[model samples]
Target: MADHCNGSSHSSESFANIPPIKFTKLFINGNFVDSVSGKTFEAIDPRTGEAITLVSKGDKEDVDLAVKAARFAFDNGPWPRLSGSERGRILMKLADLIEENIEEIASLDAINGGKLFSLCKLIDIPAASMALRYYAGAADKIHGTVLKLSKGLQGYTLREPIGVVGAIIPWNFPTIMFFMKVAPALAAGCTIVVKPAEQTPLSALYYAHLAKLAGVPDGVLNVVNGYGETAGAAISSHMDIDKVSFTGSTEVGRKIMVAAATSNLKPVSLELGGKSPLLIFDDADVDEAANIAFNGMFFNKGEICVASSRVYVQEGIYDKIVDKLVEKAKALVVGDPFDPQVNQGPQTDKKQFEKILSYIEHGKREGATLLTGGKHIGQKGYYIQPTIFADVKNYGRGD
Candidate 1:
């Protein structure tokens, strides 16, 4: 791997301005309140495996209160009663507010989620702002269908907001996931209760403050920070919730599906975890192909849901591509995300870090040839090498 260099290459701004933790309690009914049980959980920084702050641990009672607030907002508040153009204006203002504090928000995710600081600042924050603006533009354009019957009868359908939404976002991409789920629901005039992942709850809480500043009505947007078993379970099975949106493991998605079905039959939108495949033909340039495959596999420490983890190459150029890939993998710098020279940072949290190591061990025990990397790298944080295996009997699974 390349040697660590100075931090002044890309970002001219100083990392000295990393903001202090301002909000940690559950945001409900346009107020920051403690959980009903007065329980709190640690928000650990994956960079050092240390507690950054103690966040309120919300349970069923907290979820119920948030739901009650959301129901009241949706049923009687001016948020749902407002015109689409008015809603669109408010969302646009929210987007602007996000851009204003983009750097502070980006730093929060980098510390809380172990993501590369430059990536968070340059890509994720901008994408989040654009997502809000994108959905805001659609607010006024939501429409229903008007049909003419065979007998010249007029028929029309109305497009109404789906009531309260429960958003459970994963830790990998906190800011993007928050905006992706939230902007649309707000555009549709729906009240929502958000349950951010425990590992990366800071950014979500900061956003709740910004949403209020941008004129989002109280109870229209509520954020409950806690574990999935308590808060997320309540959201999925709650009777007042109209729908549940989750982005995480497939295992949890299945459970959420069952819970939604057994309850009031509320709908759900799930973005489950899985990997994809990458192919290289003989006609392609071998070096370029290797570079592409390296990025596809190792981006975001290979934590992406649809990452290109499997590779199928044409035999004519297979050997050359493998050699190039091994070379590139070794040269990848794994270190602190704040260091601009580092190509990859630590994993999101300890559970994911050890989980990856176990998978590597499984591949070794199963007799897959270890091609390049398959070991831990750093001492203080959760850092794993960019692992690659070859000649697998299956997709790295043989029993």
Candidate 2:
């Protein structure tokens, strides 16, 4: 299907004038190219349920090409061979570039990832820049300790780059996750191939472009966009990749581990799903606890992996806490992310939107009292009411 934008343009003059997303191709060796299979996927805007842009749909072939580039860069390119100070200089340049284009980058994330534009600008983009800067400083300070020998021989550990790294990121916090993975890896002189979530690939591609502009050598950084089943699996199993880092669901993390183990026993790292719980004690201040609980659940429309989904309250103050939380949820504004006044944005994509709604349905079916919201807010876009469930009990056995 052809990907195109629909609905009225939400680009307001008051905010940053974000240019339309133009670089939708896979980024490899500092160049943007279409997938070898000529496949493309529509990146739908969660705000209006319309196509934002078309991104190259990468597969195993694409992953192979990317991994090849990263491997070449690590083994023979100047990036890994450069002295720590030189690498730090380049990383610092990249950080400067990110700060220069922070607004535009944040805008891309807001529209593409369905995050609030203001929040992305105020928190997410700046946080990314901060992360890059922090790692840039570390590039020169990472040192190996000298060993003392009892005999005549003297030896020292050498801190070296771990060849090629494959990074797979999740969609809930695209901009933040991109920097979290890319910054430290770059600072450590490692070449990497990144697979941004298909739901939000714009910012990652744009960042790659900026990296190239900031003097990062060709093949040092690459990005492939596609579903997890194909490109993600390829990265996890690639023979040349020294390590695979994944941030997503536990189920997918297990698959990555299996692929890594079965393929070549390459090391794998995972930051998986969270089932965070918020507990309120009898002596706690109900108002403060309610505020924290509200932010924990409703922030980012509860798409965050660490969203406090389960809430427990002491019986003495349970009613008061629930009442306060319900009141706060009712007051949150949900609408276009571009609107500065809108505090809650739509869910990131259709699948997540539907998944959240289904959970709400199951909550009701399971006899939990729906205290506030349990439905979509508008006809267009993927906005759900801030929902709260009370009187929930664990029905299954615990391990």
Candidate 3:
């Protein structure tokens, strides 16, 4: 099927302008190309729960190609060989291009990942651009240090780019995470192969296109999209890959660690799960603490790793705080992401929706009080109400 857009003309003045998604293939060596298997998966619109576009499905063969391309670029391409100042210039250009196409990028992210347009436009895009600029500014500043030698000879230590980074980013914050992993690697003159979560691949592929437009060289950045078991495993286990940076579940992080060790003992950085806690004292400002606690857990529909899932309060203020939180959650609109008034949008996909629902069910079965919203909102889309379980023990477990 042909790519569809909202039919608005691409112009600077149009706040709702979004260019049609032109390419859904694997981006390798700075080019959008098809997978070796010739298979594609549907990219869905979470709002409508419908198929939007067909994206190339990459597996081991595609990962191999992407890794080899990245290795070649890191070892011999002009990107690594160029002066740090020159590299910074390219990154700066890319940042400018991202700013120019912020509307399009924001749209793609919302449609592909179920992120709110208002939030992506006002939050994610700006943060991603700033991240690129931050790394660009730091690019030329990395310097080697002269060290004291034990003997008559002089010695110096150099900080070099760890080659061929295998970056696996989650679906919750695709665009921001992409920049977080890619920008620093680019600044340090490292090449990379990115495996964006299958649920949210469009933004990363679109970013790759912008990178090419901004004069990032061929093979410097490659993006492959597929299931975690196949494409993710391939990238993690590739002998040519020197490092792996993963942002996902703790279970999957452990798997990636095992894969990294079994493959070539490559270095791995895992930013895994956190059941973060929030403590509220009797002396603290109730309004301020309630607001902070509300935002912490419900900001991303409670999908964030550091979301304050567990809240501990002094017995005196617990009832008051819970009442205020319930009122706040009730006021929040749960509807279309394009609507600025809506504070909570649909969950990213079915799996996450079910997972959250399961937790709510477990809370109920365990006799924890259901304070507010423990059910689905509407028939269509993956929408879930803002759920809260009070009168719960901190160390409670769920099936």
Candidate 4:
């Protein structure tokens, strides 16, 4: 393995201004290496609407390489061979490294994923650190009980590692999702091959750098940034991968399930899309309900899969609640993500921005009343106004 210490360097000043990065590579086996096919993709900054970096356009070849690395680590490397307590120590070290570089990681996430800086620092970063710690604390605690048999034969169970795991995360919450999937898998002694969303790949790549810094062994954890059709399919279908965990759209989840069955019959855990509804009862406080409803839909510009995009307000206070929600949506600040006062940032990419706009148009054409905004904010960036549709039949299907 290459010297992991020479991977990437970040200084205090690098965090001050968003540095120009050429992210045209994949991270595997503790090194940032170019794609086998030598292809690249543009990573745009949603806040500025400019291409900030060029990331590796990974395909089947790249995914195969990463999965092989993870398989090697799981089968023969020191990682799977380490004692549970020793693995826990390394995980704790990773959590500490994340805490130490929270600023840089959060900044990269904001620039790449269009997340608010305040949200990244206050919510995502700290939450990621806490998750790592939680899994670290649980690493050595994973125990199986001994079973007593009726006959003379003695029996027991061993909670062994699940071998190699493939984790595919969405773009909305990159940093937090990375740790959410990675920490638990590591704690369970599973080597991982991660494919972050193509739009928000930088934060995951940067986290891989931190993993090396924290002394994670080569081939233990690998990240390959690419489109879902190629790299994602490779990871999902690889014969050597024992399990697959995916968090993304329901459409993509279906594809992953098919791939898993056809290729290796691997175990799959899918956290798929949902149009969650927030039902407000007549007895609920009007003001609190309005506040929660507004936040649930608009918090991540409604990009999150579990975002409460469908809200059911009881008929008793429907009009009053609509009025309050309209007022709140209008009050939201939409602009640069770096600005602390801005309440909402742009969507993570152009495709999502256009999708949100199309949904607004569908709502309008379907005769749902546009109570507030339903347009773009500025000439640049992928910003969309916080939109509200009232008079939507409580029973009507949300477009």
Model 1 sits at a Cα RMSD from the real structure of: 3.4
> Per-residue lDDT of 335-391 in model 1, one digit per residue for the tens?
777777788877999999999999899999989889877877645667777778887
Name the Cα RMSD for model 3: 5.4
Over the stretch 1-399, how does candidate 3's per-residue lDDT look in tens digits? 101111111111212455789879999988899999999999987766778899999999999999989989988899888888999999999999998988788888877777888889899999999999999999999999998788887889898898999999999999999999999999999999999999999999989999999999999999999999999999889999999999999999999999999989999999998899999999989999999999998997787999998889999999999999988876766766665656766688888988999999999998899988887765566777777889895565772
lDDT for 312 (candidate 4): 89
The Cα local distance difference test for each model comes to: 0.88, 0.87, 0.87, 0.84
Instruction: Give, for candidate 4, the lowest lDDT window spanning 10 residues.
Output: 1-10
List the candidate 1 regions with Cα displacement exceeding 4 Å: 1-16, 395-399
lDDT per residue (tens digit) for residues 1-399 in model 2: 111112222332223466778789999988999999999999988877899788999999999999999988988899988887888888889888988887788889888888888888789988988898889889888898888787887789989888899999999999999989999999999999999999999999999999999999999999999999999999999999999999999999999999999998999889998889888999998899998888888888888888888888999999999999888777776667777667777799889999998998998888998887788765677877778888886664671
Each candidate's clash count: 0, 0, 0, 0
In model 1, where is the ten-residue run with the lowest total lDDT?
4-13
Question: Which TM-score value belongs to model 4?
Answer: 0.93
Span of ten consecutive residues with least summed lDDT in model 3 = 1-10
Best by lDDT: 1
What's the TM-score of every candidate structure? 0.94, 0.94, 0.94, 0.93
Instruction: Give, for candidate 2, the lowest lDDT window spanning 10 residues.
Output: 1-10
Q: Give the lDDT of residue 227 in candidate 3.
A: 93
Query: Clashes in model 3: which pairs?
Result: none
